[model samples]
Target chain A: MTLKKKQLIECQSLWKIFGQKAKTAMQAVKERNLTKEQVHNEFDCIVGVQNATFSVDEGEIFCIMGLSGSGKSTLIRHINRLIEPTSGEIFIDGENINNLNQTELREIRSSKIGMVFQNMALLPHKNVRENVAFALELRGIDKKSRDKVANETLETVELSGWGDRYPDELSGGMQQRVGLARAIAANPQILLMDEPFSALDPLIRRQLQDQFIELSQIMHKTTIFITHDLDEAIRIGQRIAIMKDGMLVQIGEPEDIVTDPVDDYVAKFVSGISNLHLVTAGKIMQSIAEYEASAGPVKEESLLKAKLDDDLDCLIDLSIKTDEPILIESESKIVGIVSKKTLLAGIQGHWNT
Target chain B: MADEVKFSILDPFSAIDIGIADWADGIKEWATNNREAIQPVKNYLNDVIIWMNDVLQALPPLITIACIAIISLQFAGKKVTGIVVICLVAIGFLDPRAWDLTMTTLSIVVTSVLISAIIGLPLGILAGKSDRFEQLIRPILDTMQTIPAFVYLVPVVMLVGIGNVSGVLVTIVFALPPLVRLTSLGIRQVNPSIVEAAKAFGASPSQILCKVELPLSAPSIMAGLNQTIMLALSMVVIASMIAVKGLGNEVLRAMGRLDAGKAIVGGAGIVLLAIVLDRITESFGLSKREKGVRHWWESGPIGLFYNQYKKLN
Candidate 1:
């Protein structure tokens, strides 16, 4: 966990305004500090992304979470240059992608990045295998090798025999699997998934999420996932960035966001999320000295013990069996203590110092 | 002041006439003077029409009927094939001259459709991709579509001279708009996300057009082709007034002689041909899903041979 990974994707002060007057609107925003609403009212331009900045580490699942129209989708599109930014710099693996020519951009896209859409968008005319192999076809790969790859990728997504079937013949969940298969078939280094499972039923969505997490673990492809659901972001993202009105409000780990929301906007989103598994013992624990001073010295043998990284759910389970406070250890030394009261506070979105 | 205003209103405002008619006449004069430049094109078109007509005429009537039946069976299935065969037989029985007239008309219709598709498809695709191009062509297409076929017939006869070639030229003018409009519409109507998805995967603009947009818009394009073929059929009859030989000429001659029987026979042949062509082309546009699980070689003459071969084995 302490291993240092290189940053693979970075965005610096990205801005995207829509409409014919976008250039003037962007200038107004920079010069006179116009708000999103003011820009829309004055210039008839809709702000898509507003000076957003973030980066993803290599092999990290970085999730951008926001409601519809918050520009999370727009922000993701900028990574692939699908929707060009009005102004900003994007670095992929230390290369400033904004400077890349169209051919270079396409070269990078074909070899390095893969994207899955919310709608699947699988070609109706193509059979599932052909659809999966389409990216390879674009790269001018031979039919035999690409089909081989497509079949293998399909098998990985548990769609072994469905390759010959057209997209419409498959169920919604199956179609989503085909979409995922298509993205990974080219063996791209980066994956951009835009709410890929949002259209499915809850049961199928969770199933696909689990499969995706398992796939990502084995592949270790750097990913930037976009979703409107906070729970989804919390579940899948190593780090979550929350956006509102085309601006990123806060970016942090799921535990950090849930336990310490930056403002009411994010607080409202996380308030409904169950953080039993997200709030760690290290986050809510008090100093071992402070705990001893308050309730006298505790015998470590009588109380259950947990590591610093153990979640509140674990602490709660440990606290149920024993009335004594649990000891939080890191590197084999007692660092902090979590009692039932502290566990309750952690569950209620409060952190004990 | 009131008297001056009344005089201004009554003045008729005839100061400027744009002189579009004079401009048109100037173009006609230029084309006539430069007729040699277009002679090769005219000769090539005439040869192709005559060649196609000869090929059709050389085939035995029974062979032609069988070919149509097999094709209909392959595309539109047994029911449509049956109706088409019955209609063809009926036309042939009603007028002994119907067969030859139908063949000539078919050749002309096919050639005109081929030329329209060749010209209209690229123009439509270009218009589809660029708003400015589409805007520029919109009024031209509207004018082409709205003007009566007879109006252009005069200009076309003057430029190309009266023959099957002029007939083709006029038919192209009449039929090209629908295909172009539909092709443009088809490209434009493709889902934006689908195009975006293709782009995200590193598809070039042309790659996106060929692999995604074109395939998705195929039904629309086919619909356009259907419309174009129908328009060409209608226009070919009108083109016969310029001495183009076909079922239309038969009807025209019969009309001059006041022979209702001959006219009805020609009309019947045209209708029968239209129905068969419409149904077959329509079948091509039907998605595989809608057409069910039938394989291409499983229902036509090929299928019959395959089944027999299987049984023999």
Candidate 2:
């Protein structure tokens, strides 16, 4: 209801230039405002991330979506300083990570952040338990304790009893679960997943996404999830950040991003995504007081009721039964109304606040 | 009758020398001049070789044969072990000296492999970690492997003089490259994603190397070690040119005297040794490559102790 959650991660104008003499090229870009293509042409330096600025709230899944070279992967790496930014500062809970020394940086990486990569990245030599316990092993945890933690995390990922098998012994989906288990075994406060499910078959990917959502709820690990798939971001993220050519195009709630993209690039990206299931009654409905005054009168008994959180698809199902407008209520109090017109507009991505 | 062209270009090929002979001569002179400075290394190697050779020679032939059979059984299985024992018995019956020669050859091969592993592993690991190191050493390793084995003997004879030490030294130089190459290759070929994942989890450089890179690269390293062992055995005969006696020396002598029967016997001994070592180490590498499963025989006799050890581990 209120925007009170503390920002767990903040990136301020982060830029990553990759090539020889990147520092000089970055300086020129900052002073003269050179375009990304121009920088590439002039200095032959590739800009991996450009002027990327955003924050992720505690316990929220912030999805960064883009085409392959859009720098979403590079951007997420900066949160833990895996890729050093040419310019800008990243703060995790207000601690400027870029300024931290190697030891401190390592400490933060080992203890504060857990990362899952697209390739699964399970050590081929390590069995499931060992791969999952790798972070703990790095921390110098005793074998027994780390194994105990690893086994428990394995169970959480639905990989119980497979701890003795090598990574190659498992199916692709199972191995990815081991990857997920490896990340969460350390119980780091933040999880950075860079297209962790992107490599799987669609059905397996969806199953993993569902499992991930359930796990995130139980673990409450603040996550910055990166993916190229818009549907994945929309399905899993609380807030989505869309990037193009190493720049953040828009960062907003999924419904807002889908229905009211700020520009054509964002709009085109969301164009293929159906808003029927995404847009909610709370987003499309008129205020209850205004609707009551304009439309006849509120009937106490006979009117069909729906929740503010009900999606357009659910409202459509509700609306098919009667001609009466659906009353959107929150906590047993009427908050707004989603009529047939509003439901259709919401489904078509034309609904706006 | 021929009109020679003045300042003929092809004439320089005959007159001018660009071979390594001068370098070898210069190194020999330098070592002789700095004999006091180099004596300690030579002395150390000599002592180590003497001790190793004595240990190998002290063991009764039957005991050594039985030990190899047991080890072969554990690794390569009963079939390979059966072949190994048959070879040993046949060698013993054919010529007692040949049997002893095979043992001496084994001693040299084992010691050289151990030394090569000690030197090659860290070098390989260093090369693996740094691309520049790999680039720098790549040409050198190529040169080492390509040069005739006899060329290695020249430097070894100069530095360490004649004995098992020189033999062992030459074998090391000949065999060392594979271990180094394979170790680096193995480490380099390790899945980059796995290393990145390890790094993302805050694994230190050493930790990533030891825990992730090395373990993943082990099959390659083992393959490299196998190559090193085979190459070392191959060089044993050439190594005997410098008076390092073994199956190689027997073969060399039998060839010199034109004794076909003796050469055949000596060559057979070497071949048998090669097969035994090859099968054992190859099987060991195969086991490591399996990742998770271990064959029942690899657990050793009774399997109870191995099961307990695995559990504890």
lDDT of 1 by residue, B42-149 (tens): 999999999999999999988998999889888788888888899788767877778988999999999999999999999999999999999999999998898888
Candidate 1 lDDT over residue span A1-353, tens digit each = 79888999999999999999999999989999999999999999999999999999999999999999899888998998988999898999899988899999999898899999999988888899999998899999999999999999999999999988999989999999999998998999899999999999999999999999999999999999999999899889999999999999999999889988999999999999999998888898999788889889878877678999998888888888987788999999988898888889889988754
For all candidates, state DockQ relative to the true structure.
Answer: 0.79, 0.71
* DockQ of prediction 2: 0.71
Q: Mind giving the per-residue lDDT tens digits that candidate 2 earns over A101-131?
A: 9888888888899999998988877778999
The per-residue C-alpha lDDT of model 1 at residue B26 equals 80
Q: Ten consecutive residues with minimal summed lDDT in candidate 1 chain A?
A: A344-353
Looking at model 1, residue B178 earns an lDDT score of: 93
What lDDT score is found at residue A186 in candidate 2? 89
Best by lDDT: 1
